[model samples]
Target: MSVMVAVPDSAEGALALTSAIAEARLLGTDVLAVNLGLRPISPEHLMSGETRITILERTHHESHAEVVLHALAEHPETERLVIGVKRRSKVGKALIGSVSQTLLLEADVPILAVKLPH
Candidate 1:
């Protein structure tokens, strides 16, 4: 099985990737980093060492949560899902909704929501 992480074009997403890499290392599994954003995901974003990483890129045609949910369904071997949660006020969260929240509810696998360091 492998770890699946969604790498958005944001610093918070980079933090999620890092956390997923650490988890993969601890579990001795491969990592699948999905980039569904418009911009290219940089190699520098992957700061982990000595781990197998597969990068999957796609257009932002669907919602982020939809893309991740689709990935989870496609990758049966995925141990869990990892994503970043930006600190948002209750109003912000209510107004914007949340991708992490959607995945936490929809994904069949375990979901790890990582937050950026303060």
Candidate 2:
């Protein structure tokens, strides 16, 4: 079993990556960290030894949500998906579509939405 993690460029993304690593360690599964932007992941963020982390960088012009959904489809071994979700109000959500919300609705496997600590 594998866990696919979407690592965006935000505090919530950091939390999601860290949490995904921990979950992978506990489950003895590998982590596929998909970076969907131009910014590369810092060295500190790549500190997982128990489970191997395969980083897939996609700097294309596609939307982050689309990239994540594509990765989910590409990786059939992924049993669960981990992503960061910010608390958005109803109006905020309606105004701006959230990637996490989209994945939650569209993903075929189980999804874990991690949020930043208060």
Who wins the TM-score comparison? 2
lDDT of 2 by residue, 15-116 (tens): 889999998988889999999756898789988876799998985677788898888888999988999999878899889887887889998999888887
lDDT digits (tens) for residues 1-118 of candidate 1 = 9999999889878888898998899999989998966787787877678888888776448898998888878889999788998899889988987888888888999888998778
Per-model TM-score, in order, reads 0.92, 0.93
RMSD of each: 1.4, 1.2
On the 0 to 100 scale, the lDDT of residue 77 in model 1 is: 98
> Model 2 reaches what TM-score against the true structure?
0.93
Which segments of candidate 1 are over 4 A away from where they belong? none
lDDT of 1 at 1: 94
Question: Which pairs of residues clash in candidate 1, taking residues 3 or more apart in a chain or in different chains?
Answer: none
